[model samples]
Target: MNVRNFSVRRSVVATVAAVTALALAACSGGGSDADADKPSGPVTVKVWAWYPSFQKIVDLYNSTHTDIKIEWTNAGAGQDEYTKLQTALKAGKGAPDVVMLEFQELPTYQLTKHLVDMGKYGANDLKGQYVDWAWKQVSTGDKVYAIPVDAGPMAMLYREDLFKQYGLTIPKTWDEYKAQAEKLKTASAGKAFMTDFGGNDGGFMTGLMWQAGSKPYSYDTANPSNIGISVNDAGAKQVMTYWEGMVNSGLADTKAYGTTDFYNGLGSGKYVTYLAAGWGPGYLASVAKTTAGKWRAAPLPQWTAGGNAQGDWGGSSFAVTDQAKNPEAATKVAMEIYGAKNTDAWKIGIDEAYLFPTATPVLESDAFLKKKYDFFGGQTVNDVFVPAYKAILPFSWSPFNSYNFNQLTTGINGAIEKKTSWTAALDTAQANVTQYATQQGFKVQ
Candidate 1:
């Protein structure tokens, strides 16, 4: 998907304005002694979120509680949400009390001080409830800035019927996967092959690099001054090389079509497999209405023999802003809604079309795993995803992430579109990223 498409939606602007007005009005309530003694009369907390699943929880909360009603506004897409959030933070006045932040953007917002440290309101204990990697996204140094809401455990999704038609086995290693792609190409006589590379969305490349233990930056939380870039690291080079090979070999289609195109192509059996996350199953099921009962889920192929078995693509966190009139009360409600075990809420949310949960306990629940999904031929999709979640490697994310990665992807796109050498394009990307980092006051090691 395009970065702009992922940002918050504009539909929530009215909701935000309404909530802000309510908050201001609540503050202006008559200052009688009894009113002053009252513990902050029912502050209407404003929340901005993207996922329909999260909205379900909010709906549940609103249904159950008369006080502290949450006024929710949907930000268009993930990318749009971040843009709106950054703009609000820069404007510094009308930001929402709670904002949904993508995991990739967590470090950027946290480091830039756009987000409040959730721990300040006794919400620190909430960290213990999620997986280590999920919790690490909003953590910097000794401070916790956000609460993990969901995780995107990586997996390989494929058409079982297509694989059988091509007489191919599910490849376990990257090399084997490539060979299978080639064979499928030959079998289909150039009509079908492996997958599509979403040139517009650079997130797939970043996730692959992270899964291979490559990071864009390293820092010392104790010092809060030291920083190092890993764009030129060996792992990153390997990732780029692999991507280049895929494009050059014609095993993967390098198209600008966003997720919609990718899903449509997959559903029509235009490709054999896709490297995706836990939420992908539901997304594909919805989009590939005609391909039901033909697809299946499998473990991701390894880059090398016996390599790390896990990877992650995307996830999100919830943060309470410092500007909230009743930070304590808002957090109390947030924790109760997000931190507590709400299986029914989660199932309802997922059923209503939000992605899977990042909460480990929820993943382990029978209700989550045993659901009969008609997509993927009734296969237990959760079974494949849960294992992948355990394999993700935790790394410290930096504030310079979005800028650096965008530049790198832009350079890559230029190279492919202009027929430039990979090495030269990557070298240019490295220099550009380093310069951008320096301008942001980060050390480029």
Candidate 2:
């Protein structure tokens, strides 16, 4: 999803340094070993995480174990995290003993052999606990590279009051969604419309493509050489065209809203609809303090008239690095944090901070599904997204993913800004993706 443009700001540098210092201090402490049979020597395992909540999990691990202490380092945002990890791997020295990887980037890391094969450390024993799709992302050629920590199941967030005010029906198809957007724009006179088109983020495009049964690359396990490319495929073109039309018709705002602006825009009623995942409502609730009870959840508008395909936008996995001194202990700690029993705790944390859980049990829990989110007009938000978890198609992502997607998005956005034809823009995007993939040594068919 144009991962190259995603980055953590420089302001977080101080926070990262402080966290790293705390971790280093913990490493210095050689407390009573939890596993007396195992080696009691102090082992400091460096871990890289992009979010603050993971620090809590690290603390939990430290409290439970004495021999192995984890050093938590903030790796910035998704793209920044990958860049730093790549640099560390190349340098062969400062890389963390554990790295938090996004699902989209798992294949990239696996393909480049940047990550350790977890199966070597008994990861297969724990494979049964995770969902199939989640597990598939971290696997390559029978080698399980990582353990999934979270999943982002797509759903729709809308302004309930605005829908009622405009007398607009909840859309069931993309065409209906577009027509509603037009009506909403006309009704509100440009002050309110459908949603903010995140021109800079290709995540929407990716989700749409997956829902259309396409992937950036498809590799047949039976034949490793058979890699399939869906970059310029019909489904991709249709999705891009849909976005282009939205931008051109004045129903969508083409402003490049960063993370903060995105949440703020929803809170301030700058946008009436948000095509998002289960975590979106929680995120909006956290920031939209004043707009409580004004929002609601709905199903994503289908591309085909009655299609039920679903797709994910963002998710993450945890992997123990080969450099770790206590790899077994580290894997155990990761499993404990992501296990099903902890789903309630994870859901509570998500409710407090918008951190979605990947554990299947948590998503299906009645407590999670029944909770009435005041921000969403007391709608049962979880019910809308849980089903999408199983409906998403599995795809193999390439290491050069960010490069190709970012280039395609830039070209498409440029065309939109210049009032170029949608088809022409898509043709340019296809050519750009093809060239980029070829340059990266991926066979673009």
Candidate 3:
């Protein structure tokens, strides 16, 4: 799965103005269950996913289950599938029975009440199969929204060699991180920078806010019209100020995410560290092997020196839509494909796909965790991830997170470009999102 793209934009449907067709389709109740025209026979399970790898997993399922036929389609990755799914859901015309959605994006489906409650279908029995944090991503208020597939818990991936070369120590807190950012630049004779501002990634920026103890957004079931948006809240502002200082100090490069320079910098040692997730190490290793044996993982630097909090960057799950005709079979396909605890399919999803698994058993599998690599000096990658995963702090994902991310990236990135304070950027983001929430029929405070 495209980690950078997935991490950059957490989740969302396309703008409603562009998807006005859904409003018209919803007028007719938009076929919430599978085809009003579907002929009665062996239920054909229609599944839509972005990754081609999923087709193999689906084939594995079809080989065994004769009752339901799994007709899987590689529906293009990321936003393309979501945009179409949203349109289909809105028009009540064309939607798959089983679909893959990022755990963060599950709230987008939930906000529209488009998801089937898998709990009613007895998803509880398989609850033990996944980490609680992963399960929570697929559920809200005791209602099961989907099945956990894969995950990415946030941590720091730094260049161990660079740290030693520059006489810098690993930062254990944000303040120390700032000091080291400046020190590293000076020590490296202006050749290497400490870290990037992670511009273009409001989700990662928001994760930073989460690390600093700020809940910038939330969705309340009772008040759907007006959601809670707090980008410029005191806590968030404080953290933004801290980052603003680093950017001003000329130590943190804000224009890093999605750029060619950023990727190249990883190999050149121009960039020292990054806040990454479970799937990050492999992706980094694949991209920048010149730094092989030089990189190591550590928990994200804390706001308080002794803090152990962590968060997710990218992860997704399988949701059986309310539109499914065969909820049980659909749910089974979802579970069986993701892994029924230590199943070969689960192993494939983790080891083969490099999904950064959320399946508890797969996560703890000796084969999965014990695999050492020359990438991090022959250390088991999981040694960094397991502790990072366990320290994951539960946080909120707003239905409007897609919009939230878009606006924040613009706001913060703009500030970094113009060399202004992040407080102003936070204000800009807050205003844009607040206006958007109001326009979307949500009451915003």
Candidate 4:
């Protein structure tokens, strides 16, 4: 479920260098004490994001809307951004007018009361224009908090050339996938793995759990006190058990994905396929350029054959803060960027940023739907994801998602390193999560 990161390992690592000790600082309890800006002219809005080339879209919006100006900053990506923003929110200082958070992080922010309820500002009118699942993600219960911008429905990205060479059948179910893993392990003479294990990727494992019908975590945001978490539940146990076997048997590559070593494996025929998110193809193509035209994407293997039920990986949304000086104009800027299909910003978002669309207008647009890529052998890749986005079975994110993922990195990696039972790791993780939730004032069951 990780975005292919688009060379972000190099970039985000650099960001961490500059934003060093943010989490440590949070632990030590520090903040800038800077208040949110209240501008006198044109309602200057400070926006924070790490998306490269997003200024192009911002520029377009600024050109047409002279009454409001966007002051944008690339505040690093993922954890760094979240750390800085959360620190600001907690400190009541330097919070931007608008912020971008991953869908998973939305609930975490909401739990802390950091986001504004956009529904009161008339977000419901924007319904039917965005994907239902995505719109649902930014909301807790009946209150909307953010505008859905992009989605990352799960799909399988495979090396067609490698599959053909190995005489492997495209797997349609988990059983077939295991058989293919064994077949590929034998056929490649231990030179290639069927796919990567990536035990460090909690998002990927969470997506797998979603696909397996696992309700691992839930918290009632309305109350913020009632929480339910079951990482060792039967469904999750089934998924982890399967992967533990594959990894133990040496059928799956045990390397973390989106790394130089992993890409080297791909180039060297070490991994033939990857279960990646919708944003995967572009990121993979950017980094794995030499492997161009060798890959193809398909629906993820289902637990039940032919079932289209699925899970989402990574995606982001735009939220106006409760401290905005011009919430209406901020909404306008958001409307300009992602209001409808074929807008300049949305076009650039898909073409330049390579974010897969969950907005209806773009989803139904002929150009977007029929867009073909030479990287995919001229296949219209969006055609493959449209259904995946639609098929995503809805799931609720616990308010402790970032916390859960951060802990999971350690727990899951330990499982892989020790070659121990993932079920036991889940038990530990579940217990820790419950403890953390309770510490955060949630009533855990």
Against the hidden reference, what TM-scores do the models get? Answer: 0.87, 0.85, 0.90, 0.90
lDDT of 2 by residue, 112-202 (tens): 4445666766778766666787778777656777877766778778888888988788999989999999898888888886988766666
lDDT ranking, high to low: 4, 3, 1, 2
TM-score of 2: 0.85
Clashing pairs for predicted structure model 4, backbone only = 34-93, 225-443
By TM-score: ranked, best first: 4, 3, 1, 2
The whole-model C-alpha lDDT of candidate 2 against the native structure comes to 0.67
lDDT of each: 0.68, 0.67, 0.73, 0.74
Query: Model 2: which residue pairs collide?
Result: 295-376
Q: After superposition, how far is residue 140 of candidate 4 from its true place, in Å?
A: 3.1
lDDT leader? 4
CA RMSD per model (angstroms)? 6.4, 7.2, 3.0, 4.7
Off by over 4 Å in 3: 1-3, 6-42, 340-342
- Clash counts for the predictions, in order: 13, 1, 8, 2
* Model 1 backbone overlap count: 13
RMSD from true fold, candidate 3: 3.0
Comparing 2 and 3 by lDDT, which wins? Answer: 3
Q: Report the Cα lDDT for candidate 3.
A: 0.73
What pairs collide in candidate 3? 30-92, 32-323, 33-323, 34-323, 225-442, 225-443, 226-442, 226-443
